[model samples]
Target: MRTVRIENLPNRSQMHELYHGRGSLGANRMKKILVVRIGALGDAIHALPMVNELHRREPESEIYWAAGPSVVSFLKGHSALSGFITVNKGVKGLFNAAKLVRKKFDCAIDTQGLIKSAFIAASSSNMVIGRAWNSVREKPASFFYTEKVEPQKEHIIEQNLELLEPLFPNETKFEIKYDIPIHEHPEWKFLSETPILFNIGGGWWTKLWERENFVQLANRIDKVLGLPVGIVWGPGEEDNAKYIAAHSSAQLAPPTLFRDLAGIFSKARLLVSGETGPLHLAVAVGCRTIALLGPTAGTRNGPYGKEQITIEPQLPCRPCHSRTCADFRCMPMITPDRVFNEIANKLER
Candidate 1:
């Protein structure tokens, strides 16, 4: 099978229209489907397109999601989700999620491809569909799946869509839809009309670019672009945000939640960040993005937009996908001058 790029595929709205017009999947049989994707923010966000497509194709199915507590605030109000099972790493939370999983479903789909996620899906239903051993992050996870799939897609979003083959076997096409909650805050009135934004954190230490690099970039943006630069930080990142703001022309944005950040990203001019959750969130909200990638493969997890750019180092072990490295040389190679030029070129277009 040939790999398909997300940009080449039709969007959710287009696929929805086609499916409805064809009178596909009648309402008489509503299957109870359990989706298991309990992971970090970016991973959870990538699952949205697949879940949205599932709901679109089978509108009446009771689609339940098992997610981690960290992403509950973000995934709570999705229209496609019939219910959410918050799974914390604690014994109590895990016990509760496992207990809830006992209720049988038509099938459980585990997109995370981890031992924990596979365990959850296995507990939920006898028919568990997941990626094959060679394709999964943890090969051991393949043991739990009743049906293993080998996804032939370059992007993570497209790989996630491939999981639906067992359910919608005859359908050759579907849409990529990201349905996130966008809420306006009164505090947004203070921001410059179209400010260039920066998210300065990464999930892994290896993914983070140097702090001084962000400061230098912010200063350069102020000197050249003349657009107000705002530093957006998540919990525990206030110190970094303040450090960047104090040293450069960029200002620190008000502390924001997931939905609140969506409102901010929707209005922002562009987002400059490393491979992190905020970067993905900005992309999902349609903000122009330039991802500075290091340990992760941009082809699999980079910004989804065709216009968006991902700057990565040319090293033999470029995408080691490691949480930490002995000598982290990848990020330092992506200098402030390099990013600023890309930013200037992107904004000019």
Candidate 2:
């Protein structure tokens, strides 16, 4: 099916000039591309494969990314991106974003299926592309795409790649790689050896394994590997972090930026976390990750690629994808021995 280019958008002649005579970016006007995937770290990480796929297909496309303030900071100055536009979240944010994204583009794709994100892509260029009605999280958002796709794949990462098919139909099955630079952290001086980073999270409470279980796993790792393990935490979870640190042999790792987290992951012997942002980050940076999954679907959101392990609870109500569950035994069902055994198996390699 032919892509439906919107009215008043550039024609093939203008497009040729935009795409540098449908060639590389060296000559005259280089092709400009915009991508919209705003908010929350894990979803953004899942969208990275699409961005890398664009670079591989075009090789010279000037790719721009738009993300929310909290998430934008993580993606700023990323090597894969040509530039970044931070979408502020407030009454005047969209107005500000409309002005920021006014420039014309060769194509615009919104991997984020929210209407706001679709509007951002819509404002950027007329050639907006996104998921079809059935596949999109927000059904109304599909109206903005000039080309809406129905994904054939189940995994979100693969579904993200399917969105690119309208633009580059032939480029399929490329490796998912995040080429961002890992920053150095002097605060990690305590790790004289390859250390384990146990990232604790409070997001999606139903997905979290028991904190006491984490304490047990920490002690087990220390006993088995003779390595100093660290408990990583973010804002608003200080009390819980401290509790885990106090209850186990794991040290309280200093609070970290996304870059610092990248650094930490680069040197980490292994990383353990529930289905959250850091787990995705660990996978993005090629860190060995053990995902303790419960309410979330392990097959869809779990760590992809090698050097990864996922411990999923097989309860009947598990993988409900619900944010809250009163009697959520999915995580509680997981014993420290189960996780410790998985860690030991991963550590042995």
Candidate 3:
């Protein structure tokens, strides 16, 4: 993935034809709006609130989503969305790009401001809006968007909402909402009987805390609270999950689909996790959550629900945001005892 800066973006008028056409469609004109947010799992989840707002503003409009294959399951079966277009980030992605352009979307909103995402948005339609590419960590990608929407602040969810301001009269009045359906699974039925549920893996290894530490924390929680514990793992964390399950009193959850995971988190008395998609999903579904922050700052990516607690180590060198760690110091600084104490305190309240 090559990077492009926002200043170096191509002439904005390249998309003038498309934007004018779509804007002409106006409130009375039925238009197909394509929302593009092909990024990491957590970012994709954050972009959902914007999708919901778009639906509310245009009730009769057709709403489509372009996301990575990893997030397709999450977008599937969503009531606010009419359809989803998969953007496979491989050689096949070019073919997908061609297929996407054929949709003739009136508006293409790129929530992910990377070069690839900008290129997809640019190639898909004339009316393209996204973050200024130079604003991205990697520059040069900005040349693709027809319109650049700069956020007033750094909060990603708020930034996404800012992009839709042009489409609505009052953007702030709209509430942030994510509607992930509840899927019934036998595993969920069994775990529904259990009280506490812990999510054991993040999308990245650096974001994940020590597995043994989580095991110790779960065991201690089970012992102190007299509640049965369960651990949820995503696609590649089965081995880590099994390790935690083997070492702790917590039961291992079966591989869960996106909706099933949401359902399980919603029903759980508590959810303990790192900064991952499921952590946000837990918050979105209105679960009691305790999020452990490591490389990322909790302030930027913390859970945003009513009943949520974030536990981050107060070290000077913490929140380095490094993807690979030679020294896993920040996470190790957060001991199982500390997390357990917080859990007990929250439960007591």
Candidate 4:
């Protein structure tokens, strides 16, 4: 008896490869493509290049991006997407996705490699494209892909570009970088002559560098560097922002939405933050950034271009990828003085 692979989905595109040219009922008429990468603001932002590259190649092809409920507000009515499907983890979200199960998509790419993300891609089409065995975060997620590609890049954005290979033959130039937010945000302009923005949230406890360190850094930037510093906070980090500016020279940034946040990032003279989504957002908008990395490697997720500096601790278990640590020694390894020296040097240059 032969063993059938349970993880592998039935691939239909390969079967019609020879006959599906331009006039047949196979490849010619199939122009609609589904792009799936949802949640964790940074991951969703990283996948934007893939969508832009696809749209650049074929402007007429319809692209549907299945995203999480939290990030969908920014993605709705994006020029690169034909539509947005909101996919939650619960039964209601599953039923919402099932409505499109009968509608056929020519190809669907699962840029996010997870069982949950894989299930969303699998539900939309049989020709689900994903990462190869050795590269995916969850090994089983690769099994759900009808086509799996192994890439040799460490950066997340570069790894995502490899998934679009089967769609385009030969290496594409892949020049264009990030997509700008569609809405214009002139609401919050930088009032100071030289403004520095500090991002207060770093996802979880271990990723956070230290609230006191940020407070000290804010004071140093104002007093020593002669620049105005403002602190930006997300949903649950309001008190952290307040604590950082309590007795310091730091100015609390006005309450702003995600769109306005992009404008703030673009205007800042420098953005100082630990590993987090807004750090990546600041990097995306060409903001000069000083990234403090602890549990994660700067090589994999740090700022991409030359206008940034990333500082990582020399601890033994440096890139442990742990959310919680018993001792929490990594945060202390990076001090306000060390980060300030880098900022002072950049300002001098």
Tens digits of per-residue lDDT for model 3, 120-180: 7777666677777545544666677667766775667877888886555244676789887
- The 0-to-1 C-alpha lDDT of every candidate, in the order given, reads 0.83, 0.78, 0.74, 0.76
Deviating ranges (above 4 Å) for candidate 4 = 1-11, 14-30, 98-103, 182-192
How do the residues 1-349 of candidate 2 rate in per-residue lDDT, one tens digit apiece? Answer: 1122223446545544433335433422336778898877889889988888777767776788888877778887776787777888874887677677764666788998989889889888757889999988899999998778898887888888888776655556676777766787676874557778888884877866667887888888788767778888887777878988898888887877765788888788889889898898888888999888888877788888757898887888867889988887888877888887888888778
Candidate whose lDDT is highest: 1
Instruction: Score every model by TM-score.
Output: 0.90, 0.89, 0.87, 0.89
Query: Residue-pair clashes per candidate, as listed?
Result: 0, 0, 10, 0
Alpha-carbon error at 299 in model 4, in Å? Answer: 1.2
Error of 4 at 175 (Å): 1.9
Model 2 error, position 277 (Å) = 1.0
Q: Least accurate stretch of 10 residues (summed lDDT) in model 2? A: 1-10
Name the lDDT value of residue 256 in candidate 3.
80
Error of 4 at 88 (Å): 2.0
- Top-scoring candidate (TM-score): 1
How does candidate 2 score on lDDT? 0.78
Q: Model 4: which residue pairs collide?
A: none
Per-residue alpha-carbon lDDT of model 1 for 279-333, expressed as tens digits? 8888888899999999999999998879789999899987899998998999889
Candidate 4 residue-wise lDDT, 1-349, digit = tens: 1111122223585424622342233334446677777788788778878888888777876777887776787666566877777777786776666455434566778988888778778777767789998988889999888888898788888788888776664666785467657343554544345588889788877888778888888888778878888889888888889988896888888787765677788778889888888888888778899998888888888877777899998888878889988878887889999999999998889
What stretches of model 3 exceed 4 Å from their correct place? 1-25, 187-189, 316-318
Model 4 residue 54 CA deviation (Å) reads: 1.1
